[model samples]
Target: MPARLFAVVFGVLLTPSFLLGQVGGDRLIARISRDDANGDGKLTEAEFTGPRRLFETLDGDGDGVLVIEEAAARLAKVRSNVAKAIENRSEEMGNQSQREAIRRRLQETRGGARARVEPDHENIRYGDHERHVFDVYLAETEADEPAPCMIWIHGGGFRRGDKSEGGLFARSFTENGIHYVTLNYRLSQHAIAPACFEDCARALQTIRYNADKWNIDKTRIAIGGGSAGAGLSQWIAFTPDRADPLADDPVLRESTRVSGIILLNAQTSYDYRWIQEHVPGEAWKGDGLQQLFGYDVDRLDEISDAKFELIEECSPLNHLTADDPPMMLFYRRSSDPEIAEKNAMDGIHHPIFGTELKKKADQLGVGCEVFSVENENDMRVYNQRWTMAVDFLKRQFESVQ
Candidate 1:
């Protein structure tokens, strides 16, 4: 199993006390608790699916049984050791240290899988900006036909993320006969709203302009990402084709329209007013909102009309029409309004975002599927969401063919 998967299972099962205090903790605990085969409110070696060594560690007191309380205490000690190691290191650490550590672990665990298919091209410039670069993983298909392509955008609430994050999906798509491209774009901190959107648009156009060189079927391209990246994908998919025939730049003349889009934990609309009305609680107060729109969130009531219009223009929901491509949305959060109301972060990624978008798609006779984790059964199915998304993309490309 991948180390990230191990982290998820162990994080949920062994650190119950730590997780239970956070958002969706109870649901995560309940999901992992299903592994307790003999159901005496504890997990034994036979019941655990993780590494035996890990199981042994969690089984405190040499009891051969692992309960939540004991596991939590053991995990606390493990955290203390990690903290000490960080302190002993000569390098300085800050807020980003934890994120960097997780990223390093992910890269280490995925090293073998990543080595199977290296990028055919890395850091290909799409625009003049330093961040306007993408990596391409060509499909390993035996056939001579150009492969369908999917461009992935990394999610960091429009503030922080890297193209390296695409490593998670690159192998999966390329092995299945789909060309995968992951790109970096300007974050909200670099420039607001349209700058990030424009960077992505330019990246798509650049890909299409060089389609023949990469053996990519430009007509069958799709876009996807998580969170802020998902919103960017939606923005590109729903908007009118951004092809500029009269533009001076040759790349800009290429069409930006895609066959389909896949969104994971997406915020379909970033309009503060729409979010406040549609999603319960303080969903509008999410990070990067003010930076994205270039407006003061606290002074929204006194904002100029032009700023309000900018918000509408930036929101993917406002761009949706009959011409938009089909979309498959997977949200990790529950659809329950009460759950959304309880946490700001939960509200930001709540399933209501997908439901609202689906409603609009249905009215326009467009294909849209929304999936959310509402219970243990839903959690089980959630593990298959990636496969379902790939199937959805395949169908989309087939339809166009």
Candidate 2:
């Protein structure tokens, strides 16, 4: 896990303390309860069907449903897989702190699943790419009452991130009776610019198209994630429907409207012009924005008008309109003096991103709440409002009128 996620999810720094070590059985159940569709302690056929053979082999009674032991076994398998994945990430992800943090999490899950929060459905493909996979974590909602859903995208500066990190958000939202989804999209290295954002849009449509099967209330859906994920959530949420209404495919016909959005330190704009105007001299890091849009500053003189329009279209700030959904953005509070002392591009976490978006939302009469560590209880770094964000999302779902 990245420090951002470890801190946000565990309510503790991903330092030597390793808060994940405290994970236990009940806590694990709370993580994966989203698919507990009936709020019961068992897994039904409607709620689970792992890689087929495993689920079938575990079905001792020839009945499709699984008891707690079976469910725990399935959950344990998920943890083991996740542990191995994180182990690989620790070695290959290129960040020292992130690598060490993932190593700690790897050790925790490898010790044995402390929490039985497993993906009821894993690696369900939304597109042909190897990275276009998703995991479903169901909430324990009443049989007749469909639950709202939130899709989580991981933050990795657009090049690296895992769908498995929805552990904290999955537990938080599913415990509150909201279905959760975490997905992997193609990275900038594989496909740049709009491709990743389009994958998210496609995933939302695919998920909503199968809403009836998943027991999701398609009308009450939201999109969010951390950093890059948050930015793409805003991209999808704020933009008009990517649906091709005339297309033959049913999935492409689904609208991408989200009732609410949750953003954690997301970029306000990907346009380099905005970066130049907003980022302070000391904090300016050409590489951060360059990595996403794939245009070097030195070559601006050679860029074309069509490319410029496409860049503007990719910027979340440019897409905001009155029709955009409710949004609650969280960031760490900082003083002007502190901003100067920060490392390059750390300013992306500064309040300016949230405040500027809030300004536009206020102008359009949209519901936008910008919270920072200084005033908002949920905005603290180590102890983020994982539950409060869900509450805000549900309120947005309920308040749709």
Q: Pick the candidate with the highest TM-score.
A: 1
lDDT score, candidate 1: 0.76
lDDT of 2 by residue, 1-401 (tens): 56455343343222223335535435544544555665544554446533443333333222233455545664566455554655566454565675466555554543321232588888988899999899999888898889999898887668665786565457778878889999999988897788998999999999999999889999999888877788889999889987788989999999999899988766778776776577654433545456666777777788688778878998899989998888887764452535534433345556677788898999999899877655434333414456568778878878863
Note the clash tally of each candidate.
Answer: 0, 7
Candidate 1 lDDT by residue in tens digits, 131-204 = 99999998987667899999999876787767866765677788788999999999888888889998998899
Q: Give all TM-scores, in the order shown.
A: 0.73, 0.70
lDDT minimum window of 10 residues, candidate 1: 107-116
